[model samples]
Target: MRKAVSVLLAILLAVTGCAGPAERQDLAHVSYLTSFNTFGRDAYVYVAQEKGFFASRGIDVEITPGTGSVDVLKLVAAGRADFGVADFTATAITLAKERLPVTTIAAIHQKSLAAIVTLEGSGISKPADMVGRKIGDQPGSTNQVMFPVYAKAAGIDAGKVEFVPSAPPALPQLLAAGQVDGIGQFVVGTPLIEAAAKGRKAVVLPYGDLVPDLYGNALVVSKEFQGKAPDKVRSFTDALLEGLEYAITHPDEVGPILKKYQPTQDATVASAEVALMAPYVRPSGYSGRVGGMTEERVEKIIRTLVEARAIPDGVVLRPGDLATFG
Candidate 1:
């Protein structure tokens, strides 16, 4: 009887010892929130998840679609998500001024993709032509948020332009139906807009062309996460950059991967959007580095936000406070 009890104890000890290391090796759980629903612009995250980049770094990432950039920052700041991608120029800077404990870790878009789109024969050929024209706008969109800066830069009175608020999904349809003369949208959405136009060519006036050197979306992490798991933060950034580079180099491969993850997404449109975003992701004369931000570039973005009165004049932000590539 004593031998039987000893044998059982020995087996239990062996089983526990064998299971411990395996359990410890399980991937850490992490969540990433995107500024909007899964679109071609979110190729990096989709590719990273599909290609096992996050898993290779010992992270099991759960990607959630956001309603807008502000929502993404709010979610990350509240500790609801470990990381998020949002508009670094307007949304992140504004939130940072409000004393939210969030900082951008990497600049994903070296140039802004936000644009004012019009179809051919709309007679809205230029920014100034938008005056007195009803433009379709989605509340809280990056284009709408930064339109004031564009208007000021172009010497146009924003007050004269009637912005017809509509849901993002409804904007294109409304424009095609002649409800609005133009629409504020992203360059990546050009394909969708053209498709909606049903043979009418869409004209794009990219914000990057208007506001030179203005940065766009970025990967942001909560201050609490950065304080506690700095290594994880770094690891996540590195993996994401790898994914970005991969997507950039293999644009054709990205669409299928994205569609695999999101079956409802149009494959042709997704592919075209990826192609459109490549230049913004790695702009002309870029330093050939993924996820790099310069202090001057960041300051320019914050200054634009202030000049547009999007944030309070008293709000102060330094480059270090807004972002840290390391």
Candidate 2:
């Protein structure tokens, strides 16, 4: 009986040994900042975390909520966060205006989300309809700042529109109350604005209609961090893109995932927003792999900004200086 038991033990040990030990995982901890508050659009990070994509890549990511894209870019440039999601146009404008030690690693939304939003039946249907109308404008929002450029592309007189200065939160309320005809806003904010308007439908005229080449959000990292840990940067980008793909494909699941991380976020609204943003994230006719950008397209974007005077005249900004999906 003793010999038989010994043989059984040896067999069990052999079976276990054949599988070998688990792969050595040395996790690298990193911080990631979203472009804005814990909205549904930003829920992809949570999805990535829940799916173990980061873990599989030997990364432990800490997610933080950001105020806005410009603010997120500043924090990332200052090394306050290892990586951040921000608007590519905002990044380019800021870079042109002031030198920051940051570079975009991947493109998230291929087109700008900026738009002039209003409630349906406001009698504003097109860009030309905005002339002589009152638009609630947030002081430094990208939508407001780029209005003149949009105005030019749409062939509307910028001076004709009346821009009413208002705080970001007040704009939606102002629009809902019939205090303003329109508001400078992002198309993604439709769900929230419609909620604020008490079920009133939103009419969005996306700037992408005229500014077709403009990019929306991008994955950013400080130049210092990228220089020091290129491999980690690549791994993190891959995992994040994977999460984005999953979130877009399964938008209904994103709401619950976002609610898990941000209890204040409305799950229904979050899901709706993800569904709305999916098209912009992976627009039709874009042949490159997800998160990829070409130098020629980047140059076209720069030229568009320059032509619109969004970027200062004669300010040299090469594609390589702004982004490299390498």
Candidate 3:
């Protein structure tokens, strides 16, 4: 869904974005892993920096840009990182099956962000219309599982949509070239819409558009850190929330912040990204809200994973065992 644009931005942006004044708690040093591009999860860290939330709490935070889902999870489980931002499926499956020593602290994107995108003129308005169309998706990805479940339920045969390996950036090209009829994208919709609005004509089909709820972004702290630096983890979460809350309300400020943090971003591109992320900001009491989680949502994902064989048969997950939203 996200690619590493500039890792240096990850550190500087969060460390200096807008951290606010809080009582000096403890001078703690922590390394965290994240892969949600410069503007997604990375932006949350930047918001913390901008708000001065981290410093007020006396925490020295270092942010590292991770490559993909596997790399991010491995960084946390291997103890190379005290904490990480990752997906619920990868975290839960690893814990249930591989028994890795990592636990999620929060679910950032309460709603699934993955989507099947198409051009506006493609006349493919519904998921079922994707049948018999060439749909691009990263091979052997979490989305591969997600797409099939969605397509099947939509009455679109999974085998009917030709699956291909392609990332979000590649989708526009493949789509414009008419090489593929649609793409299952992970990043939010504005990028595709803007890409189309600017002439690409992409149509984004968010999973929530039809598919059942599937978890997206999340923050995870290692077992070592959980036992030793619970305060640190909690402080990080609080600082992160500071940023997230700002991003949710004052999205206009993000462009300049992106310019300062991720200077490489073009205004047009960043503007599109800003719009793309808007929908992800759930209502105060809905979706992945501040300190939000539901057993029903988790079970929906767990059952989906188990049904897909991502976890072993007969596996059941407990709330307190896998997540801690509060």
lDDT of each: 0.82, 0.86, 0.66
lDDT per residue as tens, model 1, 1-326: 99999999999999999896776469788899876677777867889888888888888788888666777777888999999988777664457466778888888888888889989999988898999899887667677777877888888998898888887777778889889999988888888888888989998988778788788788889889999998899888889989988887887888899889888877778778878888888888887578888877777777776776766667676777888754
**Candidate 1 TM-score to native:** 0.88
Residue 2 CA displacement from its true place in model 2, Å: 25
Error of 3 at 71 (Å): 3.1
| Most accurate candidate by lDDT | 2
Error of 3 at 146 (Å): 2.5
**Regarding TM-score, does 1 or 3 come out ahead?**
1
Order by TM-score, highest first: 1, 2, 3
lDDT of 3: 0.66
Candidate 1, residue 68: lDDT: 67
TM-score of each candidate structure, all chains considered together: 0.88, 0.85, 0.76
Instruction: For candidate 3, report its TM-score.
Output: 0.76
Q: C-alpha displacement of 14 in model 1, angstroms?
A: 17
lDDT of 2 at 31: 100
Candidate 2 structure quality by residue, lDDT tens digits, 40-83 = 87899999998899999999899998766677778999999999
Worst 10 residues of 1 by lDDT: 89-98
Cα lDDT, model 1, residue 176: 90
Off by over 4 Å in 3: 1-27, 40-42, 93-97, 132-134, 137-142, 159-162, 167-171, 268-279, 284-289, 304-310
